[model samples]
Target: MKQSSEASYPISFRKREATTLGDHLRHHNSVVIIGMKRVGISNFLRFFLHHQEVPTTYIRNGAQLLTVIVDLNDLVEREIYPFWVLLLKRIVDTLEQSKVPGELKKAGQRLFTESIQLKDLFFTVDCVQKLLGQLIDHGFYPTVFLLRFDRLSEVITPEFFGNLQRLKDAAQQRLSFIFTSFRPLYELRPDVFSKSSLSVFSRDLYMTPALATDMTTILNTLQSRYNLNLPKAVVENLVSLSGGHVQYLHLALLVAKKLRKQPETREELLELLLKDEEIVLQSEELFASLTKVEQEVILKHHRGLPFSQELQEKGRYLWETGMISSGKKEIIFSPLFENYLHRIDTPVHGGTEFTKKEHLLFSFLKTHEGILCEREDIVSAVWPETAEMGISDWAIDRLVARVRGKLKAQKSSYGITTVITRGYKLVRTS
Candidate 1:
């Protein structure tokens, strides 16, 4: 009899050894002596704060510790005042909705009312600091403010950055903050290039790709849970192809689950990924999430070239995203993706005719070559000036389909395909 999914996989896989940051954040400390002491005090304080009636279960999930998170990428524009205003509103709303102790709820409500009354940046900053102070005084010590951003180099503006600095300075010691970005922090904010700045942002933790052991554990856990009757060799192949990238590994498993028949051999898995157009097309959605520089990093790493030391942060971001592994390796994290890229380009037999739109689309595809092109990217490139005029995905798809027909008729080998979740890429089946 097949074992239950919950029984086979268990929650242990989900709770697999937490990342260093996770551990630190979860315990408000680390395994180190200093961290332990700090955490002990924090825990003691928390224990005292929890009255018998106040349900402690709310804070048990490590969610309460993270008071606020601002995702820079989600903002349409980097307006500091509005962003903070929105964040403050969210905090107030969440607190209002939460079943916290009466005192805490009242304090949160008062802050919300006071925050709404503040109209100027100067007052906003002061009020935020004051509210944080009040929270600490009321035994809500160590309120962690989390700032999460991707591609900070591009997203961060001078005005927005100043606000962050101000908050860091104002909340020092009383509140703890964690700033996370795909790239290194020092590279984004100015004047932090010095050794002193490094000290200010101490405890730099890098999350490398998963190790072999991690992959094995994940695969075994997934296999038993899903009742995927994959052979040992096929499982080994899946690991080998994933390059220990957690994201790609998960994707491969999902693909395996979607297959009608369980693959018994490595070659079958590869065939299911590469030869299957439907499965490969699903990758377009995944491609859409990558920035242009990130896409380049993946392609360059695939081609066995090292990006500049200056570009190392970009590489680190890609590595963190599970697209590529570190070291002198040319391996992409996804075998299916690697195969898809390899089989993208085929030989063009002769001169191919093109429409005005087709010409532009074809040229763009050629420029990008093996790189994944997002739907929006194609829109911007093909209709740069008319982007505001609104180029829909359907328009791009229809244009590409027409172009594909022409390429086939003209006996050209180059093809453009949709990577379902990602976007599109030009493949030449040589």
Candidate 2:
């Protein structure tokens, strides 16, 4: 079933974030927007471009505006030629498709037509440079939003980024650019990037938010989608239950549709939420989205285990990005997500139990299932902080014994063996 109107409206719930993005645009600062996967970065960019409230925000310092959005996805190829051409096309499309002054519009169309006929890289990029200059001449600042620009990580070369940077510099910095990516530009292989091109993005806007950041907008979406009209008490419980996650919000509405006449208890609501298969499946997928090390750290956190320094650093990132909750009782935020972590290690059929440590070790070993996990490798995975402090052979053997004992105690097909002079390997038993 269709969950909600989110696809059509797409972050119609994101007023505050929209405002933040607007402020960056106002300053003519080239900005880099960092957001996590499924944080709705793409849709937010889409909504920002055509959003009714956005146009009024474009005015600043008594100046007018021209904005163009060139989605990297719109480019048919990763080559520079196609990228520049697509950017030119979107700019020209903006001129033709928007309500710009007729004089500037006519000039842009004429320039774009000539550039396209040339079918040349230098000419196409030059057309873009000229268009921005024209907008400036006409008392307008040109802002370009490059959506999914991370795709250009490989497409970026010393020459391409260098030339683009020079174009912006040549425009007296009146030209603004906003690039959206799941990671920071430095993390995206800056080796090939020209330093000059990269430095103009002096502003970093993290679009990831606290659970409550857009809470009201979320409630409004659900309330309208399911025709919900509720008391303040119920709204409070729903807020606590949804944990600011949209999937949970959508399912909460579905559950509300079924049981609104019944009750408003938090326990009753959470029990119902955890029972839904969609919730569990989505939670599992979200868990899968994290890197393996992250998976282990978050899982250990949910179980209240001590973290190595590296995991602590990773945990900080996960928390800052809203993947986990704040403070001592840290959670994965969504109640459904919490449920997945709980059921992940314990077996379904024979009902074998693995302690959290045993589970993490087994998971790591299983990740390299059928391969050797040397003692040093084991120390790093199972004891990251003191791997350098040195673990004794008995410490390793005892944990292996405990894990091996549990596997056999449950009469499972999975088994492990010491590699005599080396380490241990997980294996299949007949």
Candidate 3:
């Protein structure tokens, strides 16, 4: 049984902080909440808006709002000009239809009639100001919740900033602005907003649960909401595999429920998950995007080994690109994605034909528990003289070294053990 977002993390478990939802509402006019997708940012928003008594208007797409602002500016520039006497009449007509208060409607008219410079009229900086002032005069001055501000950073021009500043300056003391972004504000537009201004942005309050807590919560919710009886051991295994990522856990449970022939059994769940072709295809597509070197490195690691120094460097680059992550001594896909990768066949090394290096390595390791062969023997067995010299004994050694590094990095209990005088031996510590 899968739990809904609300049931997964109880409100009581939420973090108590100086900058909590209630605290932010009390102190500031706006508060931004930024987080990874499915990390509960939206859930928190729902909870705050419903439970905190704050009048919150969520602007899901800042880009869309900016587009509207720009279109309005264009309309104003092209339509209302030269005839300054007629401008106020047109502005009043626009505001009357905009549902603004009578007082604000009159103020907008006055501002329009004034000999405002074209530069100031269409300035991006002043746009926000005019909009906010209009909203306030219309009695909409509580708080402006700007979600996904990263999208706006792309379209926000100097003129937009000028208009925004005017709004900010005109806003009442209680009017506060909150902006949410997936990335840091500096990452979006460092030049436009200062570090001091960015500092006012609140960090996302993560609702991450401990492994045990997550497992317990998921099981409880599943049992209560879906009337599904899940075994404690199965729940434990699922949580362990999921790394406490709520989305993965929920997906895993949903998969198990869909294949409901002994959903309580770990082996049954594993079989269903492994045979999921859609999951495998998605995983393959992700792996395919990686560089040849990175794919080779990861495949090697998946086959219970690491890559050479060159390949390791390539793998590191992939990690930085969010394609992979390094654990203790092993290279792994991100935790949320590790299970998906494990379901697919390990890809082969590049420049080498469809040679059975993975099969040979696995078979060799299985057959020779304590036995070690000379370096020459590895080259002869894994790759004959017909094979390219680039993948010769030295190259094989580098591959073995990479495999060893990965094993050590992963801190695997069972790993390939190097034999100084001979070659290598697969040791099963467990």
lDDT of 2 by residue, 184-281 (tens): 67667667643454665446677654355455556666687557787666676767776766545655666666773645687877788777644554
RMSD in Å for all candidates: 12.1, 13.4, 19.8
Question: What stretches of model 3 exceed 4 Å from their correct place?
Answer: 1-10, 16-19, 29-32, 52-141, 151-166, 191-197, 200-240, 263-335, 339-430
Q: What would the per-residue lDDT of candidate 1 be over residues 170-202, giving only the tens digit for each residue? A: 555445555444335554454433445445533
At residue 323, candidate 3 shows an lDDT of 40
Clashes (N, CA, C under 3 Å) per candidate? 27, 0, 26
Q: After superposition, how far is residue 313 of candidate 1 from its true place, in Å?
A: 11
Q: What are the TM-scores, per candidate, against the unseen true structure? A: 0.54, 0.64, 0.45
Candidate 3: worst 10 consecutive residues by lDDT?
Answer: 64-73
Error of 3 at 31 (Å): 4.4
2 or 3, greater by TM-score: 2
Rank list by TM-score: 2, 1, 3
Tens digits of per-residue lDDT for model 3 on 165-190? 44555675445655655444554566
The segments of candidate 1 whose C-alpha lies over 4 angstroms from its true place after superposition are 1-19, 22-78, 93-101, 114-124, 143-148, 151-155, 188-199, 212-237, 275-337, 340-430
List per-prediction Cα lDDT, in the order shown.
0.54, 0.69, 0.48
Candidate 2 accuracy as TM-score:
0.64
